[model samples]
Target: MVSRKEVAERAGVSVATVSYVLNGKPGVSEQTRQKVHAVMSELGYKPSYAARALKIKKTNHFAVLVHYLGDPFEAGILSHIEHQARRHGYFVSFQTYHPEDEERFLQEVSGRIDGVILLGQSLMPETLNGLRSAGIPVLSIMEPMQQSEWITTVDMDWEAGMTQLIRHLAEQGHRRIGFMATGIPRHPHEQRRQAFRSAMLAEGLPCEEEDVLSGGGRLEEAKSAMKHYLASEAARTCTAWIAANDLMAVGMLSACREAGLKVPGDLSIAGSENILMSEQTEPRITVLDYPRKHIAHIAVDMLVAIIENKQPRGCKMESRLLIRGSSMHE
Candidate 1:
């Protein structure tokens, strides 16, 4: 392994100048920095992570917490986050969130990572407080169930998105609309469900209790729920359906097809988080685009700012309706 002294000799700069350039400090001139970097690259002199961490008191590692790895929406956001983190000279670690394992997870990650980013997990207030007390910067990519000053959050205007979707369905002459939700407690599903109700009521439409079904955030569960809905006499009145996510929307589509119902003819369908699979269905789904890449960049940027002791405010991005064949009733 070539040392910094050798890089300095090859570049004809002092050892301090080489150190300044490698650590991205301000003491070195741009020309000198470039020369030092070129020499270091030619010599393949990689800086030791342990040495840098010891000098700067930072690990350059971040952890992201998610409910599970199966959801494509979360997976897409995670991929973007990994890319952005690498650009910022940080590495990402992923962990599945379970309320039962919260304490143990926190204990293990304490002092190991510079910050934590939460991707739509419902964590206890005490857990958040513990992290805050330990001086760990946390940024949540979803609106937290419990608001805390210690944590920054980035999310979308879900109510506005739902209102737009419901109004579009109403304009297409669909008065009786049903909603499919994830049954997970204290999750963002509640926000979308409330938005659906509010939008329906705003349009003077009837949103009966029976019209709302829980699918437990799984494709099979959503299929089962849709089957049950189809068996009920009330199903005859529902002319459209909106799901909390694209996965459930796809499941509902399968159920509708199996029941001999043609999409947009018998029942129009829409969903949130326009994942890749949504476009591959027989009749592509209309959904609310959640801006996954923007959310990921904002979350990572905010967490990085917080790690540097900068006061960064939480942000909310906008969602737009992506009209497609599934919701275009003639």
Candidate 2:
């Protein structure tokens, strides 16, 4: 039964001062803010989020569902998303997406968050339908498999970027270039593979069946896969290689070293996403840089718009290809 008036008296401040502190508004000094917080904690006065939701029908919280939080690319996207959400007066909760936990996730997030921001295809179509029926809007950072009224997607222009990369390699006199991918069926860059294929065909080069290798999407996986591939005669088909990510590209670099092949001298390698570690490597990695911050900002804005009843449109961005020390004519 403790009121703001009682906390104000205990903190030796006015009720308006208490309100400012509670709302985290300006005009409260650090000393006063701390004293007010101490008084409120002593009085066991907790603001009820549920009660506030009942009044406004908004929890001011957003849920970000991702395949894994440890991935550097996903982490970068998350940091910007959280920053944008915080600027808009919202808090974020990150949930790791698992097929077995879909139903439970739906149950857990229902009425607890204002909306969902999907870093990838985290939920099944049926689960997405459940979210739609629950009136929750979704903003997916990656391209969606299918479009829905409830889901808005913001993605980079994969075909354009891949075409540019392929053309760059071709211009560097590499006609027989191979592509390495993560191989997970639903991982975000399936489009990248498709784009690479199309770009190869457009350039009159065959993306032969044997030239496609699966690195399983991580640095170690790529290194292991490449080491095995380098053991075989099939590695002779391509003079250059394109990896789906910078980490995978780094893995290729390590594998090349293990095989005693000089990069660009023996085998040229290029990467798709330019993560920070790409620059930290020896000779560095060449990659396509998509505007991660811009995409995150747009996704959060779209979700907030949907949550507030403003219809938002989907967006497509372009990626800039950075040619570095790894790729060159064989």
Candidate 3:
């Protein structure tokens, strides 16, 4: 009901000043910007997004496609992305990926949003090409399953993180270390697996095929896999285990309890991503902090750059190791 004119008049500023402040344009001092914002809030003036989109040719909305919306790690990252996007005057729409509907989903979101943010979902080449042709920038929060120049990624250095975890375990006198890998194929998972093997070899430890258990990246799946591993000959020889993520590590902890194994005393455990639940579990899980806020900031900033026709670049962030109860040996 209230218009920019009313807000400008009440604030004793020009309508153009109100427009500049609302549109996030330059040339307004901090003092004037604050005053205009206060007047607009008091007057309950709402900008017309449709008119702004028509003038700027931008929807100012971004679509985030997540692999699993229920997963704590993904959900945490989404929260950060939403917060960062809001600071830039943009809104985020979240959608879970369905393999069968990839094409239709891409078609629907191609031009409706200014850009797309992918959270560990691998898009088909055809769909990616379609988005690229449509001039929609795509930024992935993790390494893509397949490499494409069109997709700018803001990813963590999984190999480095895995290597650090392995080295830490080795330093703690854990030579017979095992890895819990995800059953599903993903770029980061594969990188962690390879890094585990490489780090073991570098430390002069054995990394046999049997030492790598497929946890399937879920709590139940990881529990099942760890239970099976606990009954195997390889489990008897292994002294430490590293999971691909914190959820899987929690499952490993549950399996350890069920099997009457004491964490760090019977078998040391570590995980990646440092999800919130990691700390609540008994003998809280040690994990690599994935820097969720930093990744979100980079992804949103890169997407904005791409939308502005600027040269956007991909970056690899490093994870910090959080030493916790589970990984400390007695």
lDDT of prediction 2: 0.80
Q: For candidate 2, give the lDDT of residue 77.
A: 89
lDDT (Cα atoms) of all candidates against the true structure? 0.81, 0.80, 0.80
Of the candidates shown, which would achieve the greatest lDDT relative to the real structure?
1
The CA lDDT at 203 in model 3 is 68
Task: State the lDDT of candidate 1 residue by residue for 51-107, as single tens digits.
Answer: 544555688899899867988888999999999999899999898777788689778
lDDT of 2 by residue, 59-145 (tens): 889999886677888788899999999999999989887778878987898778888888866587546644643556778887535
* Candidate 1 wrong stretches, greater than 4 Å: 1-56
Per-residue lDDT tens digits for candidate 3, residues 1-330, read: 688889899999999988777655669887887787667556645455445445556888999988887788878889989999999999899987766776897668755788889998777755654454345667888764645655678888877888888888888888888888895766446667776788788768898887888998888999999998888775778899999878889999999999999997899999888998999988998899988988888889888777766655689999898889998942
Pairs that clash in candidate 1: none
TM-score (C-alpha) between model 1 and the true structure: 0.80
* Candidate 3 whole-model C-alpha lDDT, 0 to 1: 0.80
Return the clash pairs for model 3, or none: none
Backbone clashes (count) for model 2: 0
Q: How do the candidates rank by lDDT, highest first?
A: 1, 2, 3
